[model samples]
Target: MLPESHASPDRKRRPFLLLVLVLVALLGVGGYVAFQLGGDDRAPVANEPAPETDQPSTEAYQPWFAGYTDLTATPVFTFETPDSESGRDVVLSFIVAATTDACTPTWGTYYTLDEAVEGLDLDRRLARAEQLGGQVIVSFGGLLNDELSTGCTDPARLVAAYDEVIDRYGVSTIDLDIEGGNLRDTVAGERRAAAMATLQENRTAAGTDLAVWLTLPVSPAGMTEDGATAVSQMLEAGVDLAGVNLMTMDYGASRADGDSMAEASIAALQSSHRQLGMLYRLAGIELTAATLWTKIGATPMIGQNDVAGEIFSLADAAQFNAFAQENRIGRMSVWSLNRDQTCGSDYVDLTRVSNSCSGVDQGDQRFSDVLAQGFDSRPTSAAPIKTTEEAGQIGDLTDDPATSPYPIWTEGSTYLADTQVVWHRNVYQAKWWTLGDLPDAPVLNEWETPWTLIGPVD
Candidate 1:
C-alpha cells in the first residue's frame, strides 16, 4: 500500500523520493539511445571523463540497517542488538554466486566473506535466526560476480536452479541483483523470464506465493534501454514480477550542493515507474501509479562506494529512511553485511574491496540501525519538500549576514526570495522562495536551486 502520507487525495506519490534514489535527468533523445546501448550500470557517462582510479578512497562512515549479512567465517559477526534480528523488518543479502554446475545452484561465499576461512556456515546461522522469528530474504547474483542465469543457460535447468534456491531456503521473496555482463545478456534475461513465468504458474497452482524482484542499475533519468527491455521481457513472458529493486550506490555521480541522495533516488524511481507503466501497458496490463510504486525497492551500498567521489553518508541514510517511510517503498537493503565497519589506521587500501569492513567508519551495526527506522510503518506526515532554495528572491536580499536579518537555514522551513541565513559557519542568500533544501548539501539538479553562498560572516 502507498504510505499514508501519500494516501490523501491532495498528496503526490513519492516513488522517486525513496527508492534507488539515483536520479539523473536525461538530456535528449541521443542520451536515451546511449543509455539503452549500454545496459550495464558501470558504463562511464558520455563526455564525463572517468575519475582517476588510483585516487585514495575515503574511509569513514558518517552509518543504516540493523540488518546486515555476516558473509564470512573469520569476522564471526552476529545480530546481537534488539533492533536487528528480533525488532525491525530485515532483508538478508545474497544467496548464491556464479557456479560451474549449470543445473544445480550451491550455497556458500563466492566472494569475500571477510578474511575469514571457509568455516562460515550461513545456512546454519540463518536457520537459527529464523527459528527466533527473524525474516530473511535471499538475493541471487551480485555486481562483482557471475549469477546462475549467466552460467546456467538452459531454460529448464535455470527454472530448476531457481526453485531449488527458493525451496531450500523456504523463502517467499527472492532478489536478482543482475549487473555487469548478465544484466546485458538478452538471451539469459529472456530465458530467466520464461523460467520464472513457468515457476510462477506452478507455484500459483500449488497455492504458494513467489514474489520475484529484479535488482538492476538505475539513474535519475531512468532505466537504460537494456533495463527497460529486461522488464519488458519479463512482463511479456507472463511473469508476475513483484518489484524492481534498484542498486542505488556507485552511480559515479556527485550531485551539486542543495541536491541529495534522497532527491536523486526519487528521480530515478519516478522515471522507472513511468517506464514500467508503459511496458505493462504494452503487455496488456495497466497498473495505477501507486500500485506501480509499491513494486520499487532501494538497495544502497553503505558508506564509501566503489566509485570514489560518491558516498552515501549517515545523514543520507536518515533522509532516505524518512523518505521511504513517507512513501512506503517495497523494501530496503544494504550491500553485504561483511563490509560494515571502521578500518584501522594501518589499513590503507581505501578503494580495494574488503568483505569484512565497509571501508567507512561504522559501529558494529550502525548502518542497520539507521536503515531500520521505519521498516514496518509508513509515515503520516507531509511530502518531502523537494527543493531547499531557489535563485530568485522577492525582497531586499543582502550579501552580508549581519545586516540581512533572517533565521538559520533549517530543513523544511520556507524562505522567501532575497532572504539570508547562516549555515555551517557560512552565510547564504535565497535566489528565490525555497523550502526543504539544506544550505550545506549538494544539489542534484545544477540548473536551479534556492541557495547561493555569500561569504563568511565577519
Candidate 2:
C-alpha cells in the first residue's frame, strides 16, 4: 500500500521533531539546490552527460520532471533520479506564469481585463520550458482569480484580451480555468459559448496555432446537463479544442461538507476523470491533455497538503497513469510552485551529517551525537563541490543550516562525491563526515529544513 519504507507509520507519521532527524540523514543538511538559488534569471542549458570516467557505469533510468516554482522560467540544473527501466534519467520541470499577487480574486477585488492579461504575460516564464506536451500553455483562471470569467464575459472584448495574452506570452495554447459556479444560472450557457467564441476569434485573428481548453468541474453535480452541453458548445465552435483539465481537488466544497484534505483531493481527481471520459464519449471529441488541478496554494479547496501528496498519488494510479502513459498526456502541471514551501513538509530535517535520523539511514552512532552537539554549526570545508552524479554515489549532502558556518570534515568516508578519500567505516561499519571543513555550506532559512538535500549533486 505504501510506496516503500515511506509507508512505515513511524516514517510516515512520526513525532514532528524526531521525523526531522530521519529526513535530514537521508537528504542532508544546508545544501542549497542549484536551481533554487539561481532564481528567475536562469536559462535552459544543453544537457551534457558526465564523462564515462566520471559517470559510473550503471543501468539507464527514466526521467520525469518536477514543475518549477511560479515566476521562475528556467531550470537551475537538471538532476538525476533513480529509475527502473534505466539506471538513471533526467526529469525536466516546466515552470509557468501564475499570478498570486494582484491577480487573486479571493479577497473580493477582481483583476480587470487589462490587469489579468498583463499579469499572465510572463516572458521566458513559460517560453523556454522544455516541451513535455507541445507548448506549455499559459493558464488564465485559477483558484484566486474570478475576474477572468466574470469580467471577460463579452464575446468581442474577451476575444481581444485572449489574443493579447497569447501574443504577449508567446504561448501556443491556453487553459481556461473557470472554477466554482452553478451551471443553472441564466447566462451560464451563453457565457461559456462566449468564452469559446473568444478563443476561436483570437485563434483566427492571431494566426497562431492555438489550442483552446477548459478546466471543468469534476463532480456530477458540478457538471449538470447544462454544464456538459456548454463543453459540447466549444467543440462546435470550430476551435481546435485541446482537453479538459479536471479540477481534481475541493470535491467537498460543493456541499460545504468537511472531509479529510487527502480524501477530498482523491475524490475530485476520480470524479473529474470519470466525468471527462463520459463527456468525451458522448460529445465524440478527441481529448489531448488529461491534466488535473490548475493550482495549489493556501486555500482549503486547493491547498499544498492535498496537491502534492494526495493529488499526485492519484495521478500515479494505474488507471490514470495508463491513460496518461498511452495518450501522451504525460504532463502534470501545478498552477504555481512558488506558492509551495521550498522546504516541503514539516517532517523535513535541517541539520548536517549529524545523526538525528530524520529521513536518512543511520549507521554511525558518533555522527548522530556530533549532530546534536553541534546542532547549530555550519559546514566550513574548502573541498571542490561534487557534481550531481558524484553526490548520488557518495553519501547524501547535509541540509543543516546550523552547520553553515563550519566546514565539512569527513570522519570515516567510503567516498565523498566521486573523490576517493581515506575515509573508512569503523569495525562495526559506522561512517561519519565532519561539517567543520565544508565551505559554502547552505545557511538555513526559517521555513527551510536544515537537513534538506539540494543542489545539482543531490
lDDT of 2 by residue, 1-458 (tens): 00011211000000122223433553364000000011223221111111112221111111121221222122222112211111111111221122343212221132333353355343332333333222234444332324334444455555555555556545554555443332223253355456666665555675545545554444312233333444555654544444444443323333334444333433334333333443443344422212211111011111222222322222122233333233223123321222222222454542221111222222332111221121111111100111121223333334343433322325332333323121111011112322322222211121131121221221
lDDT of 1 by residue, 1-458 (tens): 00111111000011122112222221110011100111223222211111221211111110112243534224545632233432332444444444556455643334332212244555666566666656556666554445677677778778887887778667776666666565677777778788878988888889777767777776665665566667777877887887677666554443335666666655565556656655565566644434454556776666656555555677777877776655455556665444556777877876654555666677555665676665542111111111111112112223454553456677768998888887644567777888876653322222334676555444
Indicate the worst ten consecutive residues by lDDT in candidate 2. 7-16
lDDT of each: 0.53, 0.30
- State, as a TM-score between 0 and 1, how close model 2 is to the true structure: 0.39
22 Cα displacement, candidate 1 (Å): 27
Total backbone collisions for each predicted model = 46, 69
- Runs in model 1 lying further than 4 Å from the true structure: 1-99, 108-119, 253-258, 345-353, 362-365, 377-458
Candidate 1 lDDT for residue 441: 38
Winning model by TM-score? 1
